[model samples]
Target: MKVVLQRVKSAEVQVDDVSVGQIAQGYLLLVGIQDADTVAEIDYLVRKIVNLRVFEDSSRKMNLNIKDVSGAILSVSQFTLYAQTKKGNRPNFMHAGKPEYAKEMYNLFNDKLREAGLLVECGIFGADMQVNLINDGPVTIIFDTDSNY
Candidate 1:
């Protein structure tokens, strides 16, 4: 499992010129699932993302978690996070999880976040999506369950 978390003032996702999901003042999560990913990994990431202290506090310090600031989450499925580009000019997606399996994991991830009392929006699993966001502080963080970062 891998995720690119971008703290945003607002974010929205569109599919086929129709708005699908949107959020206000939250984290836009680009999620990727690999073959080895399981519920345990999803559980770990859900906890980390919700409790991540990336939001600013009254003292102008980045010390508040999303819930403390009443923030939401916009989660999107992005298998390209595992694109293998170390070989030839073309990128290989062999590292990404199978579509059906990945979709299941993606849905579970979003459900976990929502169960935690955080409003979670999501893009279609296999649809072509257009995402727009006002990145707050341009704060971005990446996490991968298979590696120590």
Candidate 2:
């Protein structure tokens, strides 16, 4: 499992000229699932995302988690995160999980986040989505379940 987290003043997802999900002030999560990913990985990623201290406190320090700030989450499925571009000019997506598996994990991930008491919004899985966001502080981070970074 992998995620690209961006602290955003606002974010939204549109499909076929229709807005499906949107958030005012929160995080936009671009999520990717691998073949080896399981519920455990999903659990870990959700915990980390919610508890991430990207929001600032009264002292202007990034010490508050999303929950502390009453922020929301916009989750979008992005299999391209697993794209392997080390070979030829074209990138290979062999590492990306199958569509069915990806969908399952994606839904589970969002459900878990909602269960944690955060208002969650999501893009249609497997749909071509256009995401818009005003990145707060331009703060972004890439996180992986398997890697220690």
Candidate 3:
């Protein structure tokens, strides 16, 4: 599992010119799932995401987590994070999980986030969607379950 987490003042996703999900003052998560991803990976990532402190606090330091600031979440399933471009001009997606499995993992990831008492919004699992975001502090964090932050 891999996730690109961007702190944003606002974010939204559109499918077929219609807004499917949107959020204000939160994180925009681009999530990728591999075939090997399991509940352990999900739990690990969720725990870190809700607790990672990157928001600015009264001291003007990055000391506040999303929950502390009452932020929301906009999660978008993105398999392309695993794209391999070493060989040629065309990228290979062999590392991405199969669609059926990937969708299941993606849904589970979102459900877990919600279970953590978060207001989570999400894009369609396998749709051609457009995303818009206003990055807060332009602060971004990436998480890979197989590696340390």
- Candidate 2 lDDT over 1-149, as tens digits, reads 88999999999999998999999999999999987999988888888888899899999999999999999999999999998999898989899999998998899999999999999999999999999999999999999987988
For each of the candidates, the C-alpha root-mean-square deviation to the true structure, in angstroms, is 0.6, 0.7, 0.7
Q: Give the clashing pairs for model 3.
A: none
Ten residues in sequence with the least summed lDDT for candidate 1: 140-149
What TM-score, computed on C-alpha atoms, does each candidate reach?
0.98, 0.98, 0.98
- Give candidate 3 regions above 4 Å deviation: none
TM-score: model 2 vs. ground truth = 0.98
Question: Which portions of model 2 miss their true places by more than 4 Å?
Answer: none
lDDT of 1 by residue, 22-52 (tens): 9999999999999789999999999999899
Count the clashes in each prediction: 0, 0, 0
Between which residue pairs do clashes occur in model 2? Answer: none
Report the error of model 3 at residue 26, Å: 0.9
Q: Output the better candidate (1/2) by TM-score.
A: 1
Q: Give the higher-lDDT candidate: 1 or 2.
A: 1
Please give the CA lDDT of all the candidate structures. 0.95, 0.93, 0.95
